[model samples]
Target: MTTQQSASLGLQAETKRSSVNTAPEAPPYCGGDTPARRPEFFTTVSSLLKDADGVTVAVLRIDSPPVNSLGSQVRVALGRELDAALSDDKVKAIVLTGTGRFFSGGADVREFNTSKTKVEPLLRTLIARLEQSEKPVVAALNGTTLGGGLELALGCHDRVASPEAVLGLPEVKLGVLPGAGGTQRLPRIVGVAAALDIIVSGDSMSAEKALRYGLVSEIVQGDLVDGACRAAAGMAKGVVQYRRLSHKPLGADAASGQLFDDARKMAARKYRGGIAPMHCIACIEKALSCDLDEGLAFEAEKFQELVNGDQSKALRHVFFAERQAAKIEGVSREETPRIDKVGVVGAGTMGGGIAMSFANAGVPVVLLDSTDEALQRGLGIIRRNYEATLKKGRLTQAQLEQRLALITPSLDYRDLSGVDMVVEAAFEDMGVKKSIFTTLDAVCGPQAILATNTSRLDINEIAAVTKRPGRVLGTHFFSPANVMRLLEVVKGDATEAAVMAGIFQLAKRLGKIPVQVGVCDGFVGNRMISHYTREAYFLLEEGATPAQVDGALRRFGMAMGPLQMQDMAGLDISWAARKRQAATRPAHLRYSRVADRICESGRYGQKTGAGFYRYEPGSREPIPDPEIEALIRECAEEAGIRQRPISDEEIVQRAIYALVNEGARIVEDGMAQRASDIDVVYVHGYGFPAFRGGPMFYADTQGLDKVLATIRGFHAEHGELWEPAPLLVRLAEQGGRFSE
Candidate 1:
């Protein structure tokens, strides 16, 4: 039979089975004799296709390339196709799916805060139409469906997914809640507890887990659109019932006030100072108390409140900043050679973590050390780290073994000869790094890129030691290289553009956020943090206790206080850097001997059980040490400095503004590309709270004029130690922002 005849027969069968009308009134072009329009007649972003198998189901396929984000154009097109499908008598059912790996990436972030977001047929409006459709509608989840994409699926009468599909409502990460009936309909389909966890945590669930959660009716083993069409045809033939998520009643647990109370408490503890999580909980609570329309209105209201709020704007800035940091003005991926095999030269914590990062990405790595003992030890540490992850159920034994096999331990440099790139994670000493690079220059092929994972030292000086200076650059991965997302790609004066571009691509392959920077002391993160740490130490000399200083910045949204971070990182590392710089240190510049004195007493932070704060055995918590407090007093006395009470406000301003001032210098000196790159480094690498943006962003928000005024006041009272950056002065004078 023809498609329209088949659909008519199915609609007649559905009508015979149900007391109420199952089909909508036909439109002008609904009959079998009406010629079907081409797929392109609908919208360019999507195509309308009738199932060739004569199933009487029309498949609306979204074909936007890349992520298939539901932007204004796609929304308008999808709405048009959906309307046409509803009107057509040949289309007994409709199946919505995407062209490739993404069903949809949700609302286009590029369209956010723009007039396009409010253009005709918003995502919410399109979803409303989907939910109210008389003809059965099914979502064929082909791949990753997230945020508004998942919400759109929830609006369908039924959902069927391929085994590879991933689903989530992750708007909370951007500091906004899902506004398109996700908060209301998700709970009705899944229980209140599951919905809260899914929405509030902003985590994706596997298609298998989605089936278990009842989010999808079936996991399609074959083609997703075909299976979805079959499911939709079943509904059309009265073999399956239409299940609109909006009309579904909430589970009995939704009535429990304790359930919501517990969710709120969990969100408070997990998100800590975050605004979206609490607002998400509030919307879910509305689902329990209010009708679907009322709940959806509440969700939209809350979404609007957050999308325009300061926290959300800051978070969105960070999201864009991270992506922008990867783009170089003249560099393109095609110019860079692909990095296939990697080599890591060292076996310590940093080196081992670097090795694991490569292995995790399924790249073969040569982990070279001077001796078998150190190599074995590094390999042991790597295995232990993987074992810990396995115990957490995050890694399976087979996967752990597979990752471990990717890393080949070696005692000879010859093993790294064929590797595309080598990351030197050896000792921080310049001589040690220079010697390694010299040997690598001769031993490895000329095409291999040499990278130093140096935090503070000059990359230019290191590059000068190599014959092929063009091939040498710095890939300064943060401590615990496998865990930290930030990778500062420091380009030296003589480094080739292709080398820098290659490392940038390698950083993406390794799942690191790469920020290109120029050579400087401590590069971007550490250079700026040096001033922040200096201010913290200066605060201690001026009468702020460790607890008070740490508490102040912690309240300011720092992940941890500076002193605690130093303690956790081991004081010996920075103490060594100080000793190296002692000869060149300016006599006029004020130096704090507090850290040196603590190091003299054999206190090297958490590893040694003492530093600025004492740690009890088996605990990471910092306990104030009276001995260190006494040392601070003695240093102040020796320096002939008077101590006075310092408020938390002063502590926060001094510490944070110190970072801001130095960041301004870095930007002006061309060490960093832009002010936002500094923010990206600090937020991703230095634990400067993402919600506050970064130090530079924070300074802009506080007003550069006011910040410069505070710095000038400090500079007058504290000599050149508090010298305001020239860039800050000019910007402040011009009433401009660092971000601008």
Candidate 2:
């Protein structure tokens, strides 16, 4: 029989079966009566039933909770249901959907490297079966459809989605291109340029955009499953054609070499040193040039290659590490308290940023300063920041006003009495922090959690000033707090478990990654960064120029070179800390006076337009300075040290390994709960590249034995500064990994 004839007969049989199975007294199979043939196998990962249309449109709902990830069980269940629907004389069409907020979150990331991923009827194989189905399939996208989930939808003969649904192919974010037919089929529907943007950028597209791109046939007004079933019924009745995406021809632009070339260039610029974007472009090019089967095979080949590569491993490690950072050993999320209002003390850059962080999250904030001038200045700066976002079209005028209104500036300490929490972003002085806490204890309610935004001050001592020490902890928000994602929750000795839990929950509400660290000087990120910067300064003292040292690190995927970053952050800040520690400094230990001398000259970095590098007026770009080069030589000569040529290899090892060594010490000292937590801090707070999986994970990738050997060599040549941590020594001896 012809395809149309078969579909017509199937429809007739479906109507008969629906009438016979669904009783007249019952509303429908969904409401009262059970379907006549409810398969036991479908109860686990999916459910099968007839739609309200009284036609046998087999509604196969993915029942996996949370995100309907297509794990082995889910894939197997879905395949069996598809087979059952196809064989059933009563079922004329199929409607695939999912329960909860996600149509599917794609493949199970938990099964990425495991044996289950290679099981028979893999996602690719199941999608092939779906594409070749004789009966039409309609995808009912209820919510988020991403990665392999989007790929599955493309295999369907037709697609309809709820207005709230979002779709994307975001495999490149996990360091792999789309392995299924996403690279090939997406281009067939959305054209080559649009597909390249979607897949390479790994950003989600809204249902409206999906409709505009022809990715979804229609946006359902009411019930998504009902609309999808109606669409399926139309195809079964031959009113709508069962159009296969595999048979669709590539657009005319697909043949343009320049198109692919431009995409490759854009990918390189946007995703520097990333291999996945380049590979994604290659797969899309294959779709343009090769047949569907060949393109799919090539995509799978590339996917397997990337998934097994070191970059993908590191990326995946980071993906899990971020989630792992949220958990505390003794604290449950139930202990967390609601924080409706927050008070930020101090009206400088850090203080203003902290207030903006709360205001952006829809939390009311009281921004307190010592004087009216300072308070207005801080509020003006916040307004300017929001105005800049508005200019970029990221914020509407009403949103900008709403955020600004959330921050109420004040000079009186009494304004903080009713706040749920108070974060004192004051100067980095124990005396000053103590004074603020002492006042806060008297002025604020007993239940209010008091926090200090100190980078390195002893939090235990700060807690000593307050009567309710259990309510005191440290909330170290990174600079430009609203922009940076890290919030190091410092758990002081007397800090209550509930306080820690509360801060962690609040950090998430503010869109920050909170890593719980025990109280210590500089905590994890700053303590490790102290060693990193020390090595960078030492490299300069040893004959590496500012450009050479920074260049080497930049080549290693650092966001900015050490000297340039110092320049941007201002050199005066570290100069004060060094000066404070000078009296207690051990004379025999090496110290770089380069930064101090720069500060003495009043060239405190970009603020002064001259430090390690010179800058033009109104520009932040660092220019190589001959004056600073001469100063480095003078400092070296004064210390009676001879400068020697340094290799870029040595530069990277000293800088990165310094972070690794100190991170190990922090973990051992109990300042950091685990090595991966240190990685989270650096990756989120310190601009450490996520692709390298942060410092500790990078050390693991280099092998503990290899890292120990490098450190031992440095120790022999450079004295105590390069001494390997005991944990590193023990791990190296045991052939263990820091990541574990």
Q: What is the lDDT of every predicted structure here?
A: 0.84, 0.84
**Number of the top TM-score candidate:** 2
RMSD value for candidate 1: 7.2
Clashes per prediction? 0, 0
Cα displacement (Å) at residue 423, model 1: 1.0
Q: Give the TM-score of candidate 1.
A: 0.92
lDDT of 2 by residue, 1-740 (tens): 22233223322222212211111121111111122343333332454566434567887877654566777777777877777788988788888998878888888776788897887789988888888988889999999898888999999998888889989988887889888889998888788888988999999999999998889888876667767777787788888787777554464556688878888898777766779999999998887667788888898899999999888888888777877787655765567777999999998999999999999999999999999999899889999999999999989999999999899989999999999999999888889899999999999999999999988888999999899999999999999988999999999999988888888889888999899998776888887888899999888888999999999998888888988988888898887777777898889988998888889999999998888899999999899999999999999999887999999999999999999998899989999888998888987887787778889899998999999999999999989988899999999999999887
Q: Please write out the lDDT profile of model 1 over residues 293-315, one tens digit for every residue.
A: 88888889999999988888788
**Using alpha carbons, what is the TM-score of model 2?**
0.93
- Pull out the clashing pairs in model 2: none
